[model samples]
Target: MSQIIIDQLTHAQKVRILYKTILRLHRGLPEELRDLGDKYARDEFRRHLQCSPMEAQLFMTEWAKYAVTITSQLGLKGKAMGTIGGELDSNTVEMLKEDQVIQLYELMLAAKGLEGDTITAKDIHNSK
Candidate 1:
């Protein structure tokens, strides 16, 4: 979506569209990753349901970047089975508050666990 179109949307409209877009794009990922992405997005969106207006704006902005980055990665890779995560901007990480940073750290751990699981599954499949 263009900035012009985005500019016309109300906050609620933008939030709804961005959240749905995140879930929709995850469809291109592997089933396990897709399920994780869907659940995380849903939970995060719900957690922010009562945030302040400024907080909501920041949250939407970050997720919008995430959606675009993932879509770009999927396009470049011709699939979403591997290495879809681009390096996160250091500046963005530095800007996160303490609680947000903790949440992000937990997410990283979860993603790492999934990576190990995927590798183990592939090893077993190859062995068979």
Candidate 2:
């Protein structure tokens, strides 16, 4: 749907659409990522259930972008399995708040099936 039409939707309506869209798009993902993506999307949405209106707007916008991005990648001709989206660029990472960066790091670990492993400032420093 067009941006204008989407903008006309109520918050709840938008939420339902985007939430279903993301989960549905996950069906096109490789098996491992599909499971992880489904859980992550559900957790994120549930966590934001009572967020402020401004926060809700930002949340929806980002997820909307993710939907568009993944849809395009999945639509590619003869796309390889297990290859979907690429890594976040440095500039994007630089724009994230500390908590978001930490969440991103934890997500990376989870995606690698390395649960319970945590990073520290020392580890980050040593990696440089």
Candidate 3:
């Protein structure tokens, strides 16, 4: 049953999984090295765009091994960007709410005709 399910995945699905794993690994890297790692991964995947199915399968196999090794080495475990239930932390949630409040306040002021060019400039200055 499991083997049948695995066999049913298309090549594109496998590639997407490999790509997302690489990106998650990249996220765990140090800030200074993140860009370099991301660029390398992106370039490598892009370079292989023209590969035959056998070649692509071989490439994905190698990358899957690499992803496992990198995850173990870096102690990275969690969902990647496209995974389900990717919720923000509490601090981020609060910050987003605060931003929404400010935007709503500005909108209210605009709707009331209280925000002309001069008033808008004053509001912006005061908000800062």
RMSD of each: 8.9, 2.7, 17.3
Q: Which lDDT tens digits does candidate 1 get at residues 65-109?
A: 899888887855446746877766778677666666656656665
Greater-TM-score candidate between 2 and 3: 2
Clashing pairs in 3: none
Model 1 local distance difference test score: 0.77
Please give the lDDT score at residue 11 for candidate 2. 83
Better of 1 and 2 by TM-score: 2
For all predicted structures, in order, the TM-scores are 0.72, 0.83, 0.53
Q: Which candidate tops lDDT?
A: 2
lDDT, candidate 3, equals 0.63
For model 1, give the 10-residue run with minimal summed lDDT.
115-124
- Relative to the unseen true structure, what is the Cα RMSD of model 1? 8.9
Candidate 1 displacement at residue 117 in angstroms: 15
lDDT of each: 0.77, 0.84, 0.63
TM-score, predicted candidate 3 vs. hidden true structure: 0.53
**Over 4 Å off in model 3, which ranges?**
1-4, 76-128
